[model samples]
Target: MKSPLVVLTGLVICCISIPILTSVVSYSNIKQETQTKKNTSSQSSKLEKNEIIKKVINYETVNKETPIINVYNHKLGKVQSMNMEKYLYGVLAGEMSAKFDIEALKAQAVAARTYVSYKQGHKNPSQHKNAVVCTDFKHCQEYKSYEELEKVNGSKWIKNSYSKIKQAVDATKGQIITYNNEPILPLYFSTSSGKTENSEEVFSIKYPYLKSVDSPYDKISPKYTSALKISNKQFVEYLNKSYGDIKLTENNLKNQVKITQLSKGGAVETMKVGNKEIKGTDVRRIFNLNSANFEIDFENSGIDFIVKGYGHGVGMSQWGAEGMAQEGYKYYEILSHYYSQTEIKDTY
Candidate 1:
């Protein structure tokens, strides 16, 4: 979790045959740029209509014991423990936007809570001791404090967005998805590639609740399409940077990139970069592309990668959940649609 300060390191790359770096700025001052501040609109939205009635929630009071989560701040190298419900406010704020449907937010709240619940004992090796999770995108869920939300979300939507996230967390207090009375890890991502992939395909682990399923609604996601173009020179540079043995000449550049395999969800499973076979995940990381579900186009000027969907195609799709919520699906129904054979359990 980066504190309230946002930083950026900038290099002005000149558009020439050979790469030219004109200006370099300090990483700490990168956030001081005008455009960087403009990127802070937290797109956090509508609660779906529900037939289930609201009841007295909060397992803390019901069980006569408050549940607390030890969160390790990766940047600060400190541990902070708070009531589980309070932690979710930051999770929901950090994970999903405020503009999402209220039901979708609630669904995210449940999934995030369940994920932490299942990962309580299996802690990340952060600097702090007894830390259940770290505020890192790769290790654990992203977390944004209320104060951070205020700065990033701005003054206009800050109050309302916080209110919506808080309501979702409060409404689903102490509720988690379980299978056979055991808490299940409810993994979720930004969006899917028209369908969600099975757990085995992505992580090579089998979970009964994680299965491939049609998520046609994901097609309507805002991030459904992304296009990036790499010049011939730039493409060669990136390839040589990663795989020093890459030998793609100007004539063979068009045919150098090949799709070796495809995942069940139609995402690139493995791709051949010249002589090296690399995972699509690696390619996505190398280019900072939105997702692995992409297609490459060779043109006279450069090569273009048109990506579909976003994030890892596994578990629940956030935008898919929002689409379902917009179509009048309840929170639990949306959860069941994504998590397969799972039960919604109330610990209280």
Candidate 2:
């Protein structure tokens, strides 16, 4: 027979062991959570640090090797090859106004360089036969030759503007924005309605770095506010085509033409024109409007459109960048503000 004392002692030991085991498990879980949080924080810190480095990178130290870039000139009817820097001179002169701040010009240079790099990496045979990219924005970019530049900016303003553009291109020689060590599509537009849109929202393709960010300077752009007027009959006719047969009277357009949906960035995602629905881009295309972010109003004689900004409202806004630079922000600052989760790196 076992002693009562011995049995009681054994039970006490079991009780103690149970609590100890529970405490050990709880401690292990706590430790694991702490480690996970630490790892996440460390990762975030690295990303921020990388961005800071990019913001401060010396433009003069960038690689100066003048690479040969093949350009398909639409006017020339043949592939023309020239120094990459020379190509930039024309692109910068065409893309943005030279009257902008120097920092803004530099930002444009980086954007143009990154855009070219992305195109180079994803070379499409269908795009060009003997050229890397073309002189048209539809094919590649808007390349303004010296003569075209003189024509657009005029003989008087061309000299000063051209020099500023050249300075920007020379300063940021071979820099490109990269994400995960790969060239990224540095899409820039004319203006925005205060904020940019995520790539998925505008294009249906989710790009990590192309997420929406607020651009306070966008509203300051000269083209920020524009009005377009059209007859109600024209508006309804376009809607009928989009709807594939919808009966919409002129009265319906005045009473019911409204925005049905909006993207997170405040751009019109879908709008109701009478009984039919259409995308914002469709409205812009049909009427040759300034931007997708617009409001429709019914006037007694015609339909009036109050547009907030210009372009597709995705990626960088050139005027927005210029405004930012004018407000004392640097070139890298403008780039970082527009493109989220991206780093500017030297192409060398």
Provide the RMSD of all predictions against the true structure, rounded to 1 decimal.
25.6, 12.8
**TM-scores, each model vs. reference:** 0.77, 0.80
Instruction: Quote model 1's TM-score.
Output: 0.77
Query: lDDT (CA) for every model shown?
Result: 0.80, 0.84
lDDT, model 1, position 160: 72
Report the lDDT tens digits of candidate 2 across residue range 276-340: 67788888888888888888778766788898888888889998898898887788878888888
RMSD of 1: 25.6
Backbone clashes for every candidate come to 11, 0
Where does candidate 1 stray beyond 4 Å?
A: 1-65, 124-128, 154-158
lDDT of 1 by residue, 163-246 (tens): 889999888888889887788878899888898887776777988998888888887788988899988878787877888887
